[model samples]
Target chain A: MLNEKEKHRYSRHLLLDKVGLQGQEKLKAAKVLVIGAGGLGCPVLLYLTAAGVGTIGIIDFDLVDETNLQRQILFSINDIGKNKALAAKHHLEQQNPYITIKAFAEKLTSKNALELVQQFDVIVDGTDNFSTRYLVNDACVITEKPLVYGSIYKFEGQVSVFNYNNGPSYRCLFPEPPKAGSVPNCSQIGVIGVLPGLIGTQQANETLKIILEIGTVLSGKLLIYDALSGNSTSINIKRSEEQIDKTKAMKPHFASFNYDAFCGIDLINTIDITELKELLKSENIQVVDVREEWEQPRINELNALIAPLDDLDDFVNQIDRNKKVVMVCQRGARSLQAILHLKKEYGFNNLINLEGGLLNWK
Target chain B: MKINVIYFGMIAEAIGKNVETLQINSIQPNTDDLTTFFIQQYPVLKNKSFKIAVNQQMATNNTVINENDEIALLPPFAGG
Candidate 1:
């Protein structure tokens, strides 16, 4: 099945003993689905496309914003404001015409996840939130497909292969999602742009290995790469039947399972930054910033009171009870936690969360 | 006993260090006890969720820790 152009296109891969003519054929027959065309998704899509994977599917509802150019290398300034999956498809198609790339410009909801993942041989999770990540893992587990997982935070990244050859799933490692406000994302903190490239490349390599059956798969193993330290550490994990069964039990209700609630994407009283800006001009609202003092993008226009979430006890007496308090943090989750905490622990009822925090103020 | 313990992702930020030489005052402490010890030392760690790895292997609450073993406090990173 080697057309002249196909063989010439994959000449480099054809030369490798591990990925020769037969391996190239296998790759051409493999179908891989990538979720989230964001930071990690960029490199994974690029490399996988270049490697001549026969069919690739990308599903991301996000748009190609200017902020994505730093890490999402698929989109240029011309492609800004475009759907990420469609924009990625446009570039990847030019990279390798020998392959087929499918773009789904829709969000991966609970309803679509199971059916969509069932079509792919391997699922690559480059999503940025706990809810989607958990949803992807459960779908892969229920569908019995391998998932190549990668995540980045600041200068570090984590990579692992779950549900491969009956290995451990994500739940087997972290059975429960972290408290919603406890973990700050790249938007809240920041990420070294190159970090996801490294991690995503590793994920691409794993996908190729899985397809070619050449090397040791990263099943039941988690790889932690620290760009700052230039060191990679491995942690061995065991498959938990209980965790696997828990996911399988949801197979009947897979379409209706509320992953958002599972990950605590909660329903809390929130006001957007623009609304808060408008409110400050009219009413006397008390603004309390819940982020650490060291966090960036500080908004001084509100003349907000600084009360870090960790040490809120110190500022208990300072927060006015009579005033309508607006809680804020780097991304708003921590501020929501602050409101819930103050409301529950101290019986304060007049608290509201600042949606999306200071990061979205601009 | 003092052991080499490493922290990852947000856990490191909470502890204010990537790695540390932690001194355990308990006799043959389990993973649960070590976690409690850490929460007591760094109250900030009580916010983030993480798991423990003993010498490159995942540890359960009942997993025992020995002297000179490498320990890693790993957290699930939510970034891409």
Candidate 2:
């Protein structure tokens, strides 16, 4: 039974031909959990709150930064440096006072992923990295919860619903994470301010559709959108039968590995500063720093060259084929691309990607 | 064979546009041949890393390219 204020608060929603009284009731009964209160989470929570989801949980370990204000619409300049989940909860509650908003101000780890995910009717992933994406997928599979996933790069974004009614999981679509530092984050690269809002709103729409049982759900399908051309493409994803295991009958457990370590952040497997110093004695390989000119710790003694990523092509043409090129960048992403290009163009297969780049040089 | 060369993500930004086409007239051009063609045309691409997709699927360096196939030059997918 709708209360007097409730009826008026959502009168437009209740009057909609597709979403009537029953739909409103369905929304009121739904419990949704959103992971990450960053760019994607801001709009997702805002929309879900406006639509009157019964309960919403927001989890984030990060604090707000000046850099986040460009796309994180739920936050203001005053909220800078505050905990993201707490700030998001405070703001979202004010937006829709009738709906319940819970804030979990901690990192989402494998230990808590399964238990936390099982508590909600729907899970939305707004995480920005690969390991969390995988963790969310695995946990969703374990809990049989539907996941609305959205991600944005420089100018393109991808949105999908995974683990819905035994649909394909994120792992089924992307079996493995890419090699470390292969691509830069929005922090390293950049994204348009409105890109996340565009993608996040779409994610929120998918969540509502799932809750109210409305329009087509993006199950077993990956939708890729390009902001530049305004083009959208849907790729069909089929479930891999062999990958599905019936081991849920046994004790359910969470993953135990550190995602940062899994993503190659540890420096053990890579060459160290001393090893690099030893290699500098050889004239056969030329170390090219792809970091910007102003970046610190510039090497002056070694057999090295300064070539910013913007000028990599012009410098590539001048290199000698006899000398191997060891590319270096701040985070190794730009250097890897430079190495790949050198190997592809000049047949310099001897190029090596300086793991972790100059930041890990020591 | 004429193949449409599609650029995506950072690759498009580097190329300053989204779509382009390349003509290859061998029985099946090896990945090296396509690589050489691209580098020869746009020397700047020689310093950028990318993966080739034959009809929306990731292809390897040794993958053979057939005529009229839709080839996509995709930068690394950074999205979660």
Candidate 3:
């Protein structure tokens, strides 16, 4: 029922024949949960709030920083150091008095992602990292909620509506995460502030359309927008049951799943001297020497295979597949490289690097 | 066969060009073939992941590439 004040509030929307009183009611009945209060999140939250969405949940653990001012329009100098979600909620509540805003100032982890996603009809992904992006996608897929996805690079942006009515998930677009450090983030790199604004508004549009059931949904489609080129193109993506089922299978162990390790982000599994000694005594573990033959003071008792870092390709066959492989080098850097290379190129999950190499291996 | 390869995002930055016409040796090269050639030219891309689109259609590694087709290489963006 549109009260007199409510009708005055959304008069523009009501003016549209397509979005008459019925669509206004649908908007008021809709529940949208936006993840992240950063660049894309700011716009998505702004529009959804202004449109009189009945309930909006904003979950962002990030604090409002001075650097975020160029884009994250929801925060200002006074709001700096405040949690983005709470700050966004405060401002958005004032924007539209008719709506309810729920703010969660916590990181979205596997343990909590599913529960939060289930509360909303549409999930908007505005996170700035692969780990959280994948987490949001998996949670949306498992909970069967439509996801309005948007990501921005320096001058380019990508927007898609994923997991809408059995459409393709993000995994169907890129099943495996790119090796960490290979792709730089917005901080490491830089993004045009307006890029996210452009992409985020599109995401907000998608969310409204999904709720209003007007126009075609962006399911199974990936939209690419170039700020510099001034062009928008979309690639047709097919729903991969394999990708969807892999995510579904993880439902049982979702809480235990480590998205950081899956994305090769900050997986630090180095064996110390004591642990190395114990593992060596346990037998059948392969200790790989990534140092060059001439670079090391050899250990007569360790019997470590000398596969230099530069020549690792030649010794790939000799590396044991089923057994544990420990990589060692002069310092710690080369061994870490060996482990990362072996893991990325050869899928050797059994390899562990020895920290500080043999520097203190007396 | 001569085909136009369009690069997007970081890939375009690494390649230093948005579009290029390359003459490939194989008559019917798949997306993998282009990937191999690019990796050989720019080893920086050897580790970075990107997806190929043939004439605006998402393509797999085995998806065949034909002459005079527009192939787009788009990398995943990690920004909001």
Candidate 4:
């Protein structure tokens, strides 16, 4: 039952036949957990609060960066260094006094994913990495929670509903993650400022529809939006039996699943830019640039060998096995793949991938 | 068979074009064959991973492609 203030607050929602008094009550009763307080999360959080979603939980360990100001409208210049989840909650509560906003300023790991996700009726994925996406999907499968998924690139975005009423999960659509380094993130590439705003609102709409039981949800379908072309395409996704079986097999032990290992993100052989800079001044170390010759903004400080990844075989013999070899690429991805190749093919264990690659070298 | 292929996001950047029409001899070409043909045509896409969509439907490698089919190459984006 809406109180006097609540009735006046949601007057617009109360007028709708689809989302009348009963639907408004449902919105006030639903608990949605949103992961990542970045681009998509900002708008999703904003609209959800305005729509009167009762218990909204935000889990993001990231702090507000200067780069986030473009799309993350929840923060201003004053909230620059503050934690994203906390900042978002602080602002959202001010937006709607009738709703409850919970902020968890912690990373969602394999151990805590299920525990945190199980408390919510629905999960909204706003993360920007493959590992967290896979983890969130598997956790939702285990906990049997509906997931509202959205992703953005330069001028395009994808929105889908996964594991809704036992619908096709993310793994059913994308059985396996693309090989590491093959696909670059938004940071590596770049996104238009308004792309996330468009996509995030769609995600928030899906969440509201799910809660109100109105409209056709995006289950078993992918919504592809090209902001540049103003084209929207919907592709039907069929659930994979094999993937469902695999997910079922791990349901009992889902907590123990190592998503990072499953995604093959080798964190052991990575060296940050600062460490790489320090290593360059030391002896018995060779830096190898694995990027193609045509790739731009070459690293000039290091007298590194120009061994393009495709032609690494030709230059493999030139690298001394005795000296520690550090691999470099435009971004850190190619270098990690190079390290894996060198280790597997030539048995070169003395290699390290420069984290964030030459992009972060400065 | 001639198929209309569309590329999106990074896949388009690597292919240097958003859309193309490919002529293949196979009467009923599977996604695997289309992938091989595309990679052979655009060597830059050899290392990239993308999904194939046929006629606005997500398709598996075993899914068949016919003449005048609309196919799209979609790369997963991790951006928020």
Clashing pairs in 3: none
Shift of residue A218 alpha carbon in model 1, Å: 1.0
The CAPRI category of model 1 is medium
Name the 10 consecutive residues with the lowest summed lDDT in model 4 chain A.
A341-350
Native contacts matched by each model: 0.90, 0.34, 0.82, 0.85
Alpha-carbon error at A19 in model 1, in Å? 1.0
Best by TM-score: 3
Tell me the interface RMSD of every candidate, in Å.
0.8, 3.8, 0.9, 1.0
Error of 2 at A101 (Å): 0.9
Residues A290-359, model 3: lDDT tens digits: 8878875788677888999999989987988668888888778999998877654444567788888887
Tens digit of per-residue lDDT, candidate 1, span A221-328: 999999998999999999999889878877865665556656656555789988898889989989999888889888778898999999997997788767778998
| CA lDDT scores, all candidates in order | 0.89, 0.77, 0.89, 0.87
- Model 3 DockQ, alpha carbons vs. true complex: 0.70
Worst 10 residues of 3 chain A by lDDT: A341-350
Model 3's CAPRI class is medium
TM-score per prediction, in order, is 0.79, 0.70, 0.82, 0.79
The candidates' DockQ values read 0.67, 0.25, 0.70, 0.65
lDDT of 1 by residue, B1-80 (tens): 98899999888887789888988997898899988998999998888788999999998547999999899999998799
Distance from true position, residue A274, model 4, in Å?
32
| Pairs in clash, predicted candidate 2 | B1-B24
| lDDT for each residue of candidate 4 in A1-362, tens digit (9 for 90 to 100) | 78999999999999999999999999999999999999999999999999999999999999999988988888998899999999999999999999999999999987799889989998999999998998898888878899999999899999999998768999888877777766777777878889999999999999999999999999999999999889998888987777767776666545555566556565547888889878878766898999988887777887889999999889977876677788999888988888776653444556888888787555
Candidate 3 TM-score versus the reference? 0.82
